[model samples]
Target: MREISLDRLRTLVVIADLGSFAQAARQLNLAPPTISLHVAELEARVGAPLLTRTRGQVRATAVGQTLLERARRLLADAEQALEEVRGQVAGLTGRVRLGASTGAIAHLLPSALATLQRDHPGIDVQVQVLTSQASLAALRDGRLDVGLVALPQTASKGVKLMPWRRDPILAYVPADWQPPARLTPTWLAARALILNDSGTQLSRVTAEWFAAAGLYPQARIELNYNDAIKSLVAAGYGATLLPQEGEGPELDRRIVCRALRPGLWRSLGIACREGDGDRATGHVLAALKHLRQ
Candidate 1:
């Protein structure tokens, strides 16, 4: 059987409403013959006599009433879907998938997301916590719309990176330790340390900082989540080096943050597929850009 057309469905609705073929045609701006053909085609497709004439007035048969009810719902749903698509195209509403490291998600994304909520309330940003490498891979595979990634990443095909923000790395140590105001690699290496997981960009950056000073320090424990690392630091488990993002969150009373002596910095970049993105993605990109310092 052939698929039913919305045009024919609409014609039937108009005829039922007006109860006259000529009146429906005038309302629809269709010829009387075309209107008659529309009903005939609908009846033929359903294999039923859909209309009855009583005193020159038209009305639907039982089967036609059932089909008409369903058709009305279908038509209303189609219209709503089109309106939503139009809203997305206009950058008024959409769901944008975003990827970022746990650290960024904790310290950086809140303000950006708040601004988005204020300005573009219809744009829903879905965040996924991912390592920089994982985020880039997701972008390459079309799984993510935007990624806040560590800078100095290896260039990948079909992905583009834009410099977003740079923050100084700091040492988070137990307050009772009374560490120096500025921590050096040698000073830090001598202490037990909680560190980011080996797979993370921050770990590599931290390693390079220590290596440049001719020191290679082993971590007391390595984990990916920034809050967990800070919790360990607060508990006096070990000190860890992490970026001090945008004034940062309030530190635990037992934890104090210190600047690194050599001023190590962690840089971040926004990554997206290297082509035109949908308007919703562009709106989110703009919101992220507003967070740069």
Candidate 2:
């Protein structure tokens, strides 16, 4: 029996994603005929058709879908194995793409990334600031190598969540607005609020926190980015609940962060697609853990 080749599996995965042999060929930088041969060989090895080809579109069959999943995992593993052989003796030299919330990018990640760069000057890190949902999607699609996300109650399909640190969630109020010594649900509800946008874990948690207090806030303004939310609060637009790290010089001067009476907190964590647990991934995780301490 002929062994299945990584080359064929890659072709299968690319065709599955790109939805056309020509598109797959273009993506892989291979001739269309070569891609056809690779898919044919893969079908023969598996003893079933992996794809349904029509006029211009390619669709994966049940078996094809299964193989595509395994093929992506296999390809990611093979790439990681290549890096393992290269090792840290290779001095962590590779592009590491990371996704993080804007707040994390502004305060939480800079120091950690600085430590990583200082220790491994060869590693080129690309950080994308996005909403938590966007970050999860990018990580699953293999564009982002890892993510720094606030722990969501429910995990996404292909990622593993690991707690990295906890940040106090404080209420940021305009300096001119003085509140009672202790913040009550009624008092909080009376104030207008700014919130993180829909579809974000932060926004969901914020809703949960308010609901738990039996308080529905007055008119709420939604913003997609935490940095923007802070800016709005700093400009005295409205108070917002934000992670403590959101209190920077700009915010401190114009706003005051009051720690919640019962101490509301958010958990920030390191996350990666489940199968990306290679030595380099582990090393990066270590770097995050080191920073957390």
Which candidate's TM-score is highest? 1
In model 2, pairs of residues that clash are 88-91
- What lDDT tens digits, residue by residue, belong to model 2 across residues 142-166? 8887888878545878888888888
Per residue, candidate 1 scores C-alpha lDDT tens digits across 142-231 of: 999999999899998999999999899999999999999899999999999999999888999999999999999999999999899999
TM-score of 1: 0.98
Q: Rate the local accuracy (lDDT) of all candidates.
A: 0.93, 0.78
Per-prediction TM-score to the true structure, in the order listed? 0.98, 0.65
Clash number for candidate 2: 1
Off by over 4 Å in 1: none
Task: Estimate the Cα RMSD of every predicted model relative to the unseen true structure.
Answer: 1.0, 14.8
Runs in model 2 lying further than 4 Å from the true structure? 1-91, 246-250, 276-279
